[model samples]
Every structure is written in structure tokens, then in C-alpha cells.
Target: MNATAALHLIQAPVALCLDDEINIDLSATDPDGDELVYELTTPLHGANDIDPTAITPPPFTTIVWETGYSETYPIDSEPLFK
Candidate 1:
């Protein structure tokens, strides 16, 4: 279980009303030839929802893990709050 896998965002400015999809790419060859599996240890939120005091913005961390694995990316919607 390595934690060096880099996570990226495919889309930005995710909306608060709609659910978003995120991709996690984890294609790598280990020296010991270990099969790699990607799992989200923690929740990733959009820039808007990060700060709670910002007038209750829409949900920004709804990640739907797809099949397969290398670089983890996120699909963001439009911003609900200002």
C-alpha cells in the first residue's frame, strides 16, 4: 500500500446540486510485482466547500470511484454559492 500516488482533477468548479465523478489512475509496476489497487482513504472536497463559514456552499466531495487504477482525477461542477 503506497501513498505516493498523485491525484488529479479532470474537471473543475463542480456544482453543488449535481453529483460528480472522480477518476483514480494507479497504473504502476512495483519491483516486487505487486498488483496495485486504488482506494480513497479520505474525502476530497472542492475549493468552495472547504471553508464551512462560506455561507453553506453545495457539496463538493462526492467522488464516485470508477473501475481500474494510476492517476486519480475529479469531475467538478459549477459553484452553487458565491
Candidate 2:
């Protein structure tokens, strides 16, 4: 369920390990030739059933990671897509 994480799932170019940390490519393209800028942003998460107010505005909470996981790494490997 938590695919495309970190940089909306694209920020981290490589997977992270617990013992070793590495740099990831946070690069973005505009499709058209244009200047590029980078900035850090927070990830949001909530319940799927609670559809009410899911997109209703500002002051969103950041996502929390569990053990052996960050955002992009340690994803479920079942069913090919999970």
C-alpha cells in the first residue's frame, strides 16, 4: 500500500539499509526544458476508510516509519505489487 514513498515514491533513487546509509537522487524533470529547484517536504498518511476530509486543506501530519523501514525500502514483496 505504501509505494512511491520518500519523494512521493521517486525521491530516493536507491534503497536504504540499516547499517549503511547512502545518498539518493532527489532530482526532478519538468518534461519541458525549464529550470529545476529542490526542496524538502513532509509525507502524509491516514486511514483509507476515513475518506472524509482526506483532501480538505492544510496542516497535514507526517508519516511514521516502523522497524527495518523508512519510506521506500522494506516494502511488501507479496503478490508482485504489494
What's each prediction's clash count? 13, 2
- Model 1, 20-43: lDDT tens digits are 544344355555555667564435
| Root-mean-square deviation of candidate 1 | 12.6
- Native-vs-model 2 lDDT? 0.51
The positional error of residue 70 in candidate 1, measured at the CA in angstroms, is 21
TM-score per candidate: 0.23, 0.32
Off by over 4 Å in 1: 1-25, 44-82
Which regions of candidate 2 are displaced past 4 Å? 1-31, 35-42, 72-82
Assess candidate 1 and give its lDDT: 0.46
